[model samples]
Target: MEENATDGLPLAGVTVVELCHSVAGPYAGSILADLGADVIKVEAPGTGDYARDWGPPFAHGTSTLFHVLNHNKRGLALDLRDRVTCERLLGFILDHADVVLQNMRPGAIDKLGLGAAALRARKPALITCDLGAYGRSGPLKDRPGYDPLMQAHGGIMSVTGIEGGEPVRVGVSIVDQGAGMWAAMGILAALNKRHVTGQGSHVSTSLFETAIAWMSPHIGGYLSGGAMRRPLGSGVTEIVPHQAFPTSDGYIMVAAGNDNLFRALCGAIGHDFAADARFATNSNRVENRRTLIPLLEDIFRVHASAEWQSRLDAAGVPAAPIENVAQVLASPQTAALGILQQAPDLDLTLAGLPLEFDGVRPRYRHSAPALGQHNDLLSEPIAPEKAAS
Candidate 1:
């Protein structure tokens, strides 16, 4: 047995049976794994996860997405189409597992007799969570959804891109990853409750719900006033001088959200906008954003983005450079945060949990597993070559 990093940690003895694939479901399992749970990822045999083939840029003959979302888990590839294989999975769940989470489409788990109601009835201490696309009770409950599709349905696309520009998906898988985080939160809550009652709970979240949750403030405002809020191209409502502006070389985001900061920002930029009646207060600046913003834009264009960012930082104003993905990955801040954890066995680097306990963040002890790597541990061993044909 390999050395598990979970010794002396919370959830050291917890076993998670993850019947999930792709980003959302797998990410939830990954979160638990990082917190020291023994997560068993059950993938379909043959192709394993469809995401395994989703890359032209494969790492070690597998999808990078698979690698990122699957660290610290033991992989078990099984052909669930076979009755015996499905039975083996459920047997392990009933006999040993603490939590079960799946993101398979609607009716899929039910048809396989792995529904939450059935599983919970068998093991009252088994926590089961379903990560769905739309929801469990909506008219579109059965409909499948992807990250981009959910983004369009959940109003993220409406407010995401440049003002009046063509609708563009958010660069990251916000809906999928957000839903995953929510699932982990729900499971943790349930686990806490279980400690008291010794009973498991059914938990669920959906991509659509995650997307809508992210847009709640904006949606609430629009719904109340019946006035649509247009995309501000990185600008926020009720705040003037809170957007990215082009400098001599690049763009930098600035936020002088209040009166004092506004005055300070004007001084830093060598402008007298604070004295102008039209830009004196936050309300006035908001009202005359068109006129005042262009003036700042003109002044900002005179200096490089680095110079403006430096001056704004020196003045204690909220400011950041509009860095590209590569710059962000290579930044000192990323190194300082220590978010990246090493996986020497898999020759991979993964982002660790975004939090610390006792001043130490958990590290990845296990790299991602090969298909059916742990299948021998089960009574029925599944082979990756046995694709569901």
Candidate 2:
């Protein structure tokens, strides 16, 4: 596809300054960059974003995880602890940026004189987003939070493992990602509000809040019913025959939600299992799930997953073969849907944005930046003494 000036992306001409590091904050900046914003990432002087060292999956000796989250942004290293250099860069960013994003510890930015209140006072229309492990003020506000810690404290670990097994944290950093997404939404909302009111706003999101919000439904259910949720592994609590069933070769996921689908599933498998009084309805199936699951498992185990998938698809039953990351990447559906793209410069392939707008598609303009790669562009033309210290 031909690349236009803003690569046909939606957030064209927007400029964002990101004073953030690691997964949560940088991921938000990457999203803005994906939508065609000019994102400039500010890093510390010597060693940059902490994620740089977080890897065994390194690409060209750099952290692949860091590369993925920081794509399509420019990087500048500055000594923010130095008052002169800090003031110069702050002034420059405040002058040109539409949005400023930070993920520092509470009071850190304000101590540096670059807090939202200070910045907004200088540029009334500049939006600022502050992301943290917890909110700025609270009883536990000073406690440091990371993804795994949040998972444990947020109740996700309580319902993630095998039945009767020790609680397990999710394999991915879901809390960080959730917080990043919420921050992005807030930044966009604040920008829209600025359009009408001609003033900026402070947007704040925390990992603690994100994890709690994610646990609301489970917590609500527990509060209302006085029932403790046990880990069911891949099985859902309220649904029967909805989990992965092993086949001769691999596995397939089948969900028979209603009576019609349940009957159809049984018919498609050449069995009338649904006609049994114990499995005649959704409620019955849920109650006798142990019996129904074993029966379906036995039936499915007779064929390979692909064979069952084709047969079920032909019968208009909703079924899909379980796929790993490699299989998903190789699937024709993935290519046709344009879920992955190659970044020639970085010599890597990445998953693109999960959105489409009015038939317009986003483009990958550049690979993730090298540490402090844009320092020259960001350097202020100040006196030698000012630039020196």
Candidate RMSDs in order: 3.8, 4.2
In order, candidate lDDTs are 0.86, 0.82
- In model 2, the Cα lDDT at residue 56 comes to 79
lDDT of 1 by residue, 1-389 (tens): 24545775677788899999889999999999888888889998888888788887678888888888988888889888899989988898888789999999899998888999999999999999999999889699999899999999999988887787999898999999999999999999999999999999999999999999999988888888845776788897678999999999989999998999998898899887899999999989988988998898999999998899889988888899988878878999999988888875767777789888888888877677889988875775422212111
Top lDDT model: 1
Clashing pairs in 2: none
Per-residue C-alpha lDDT of model 2 across residues 261-301, encoded as one tens digit per residue = 88888888999988799998887887898788888889999
The candidate that achieves the highest TM-score relative to the unseen native structure: 1
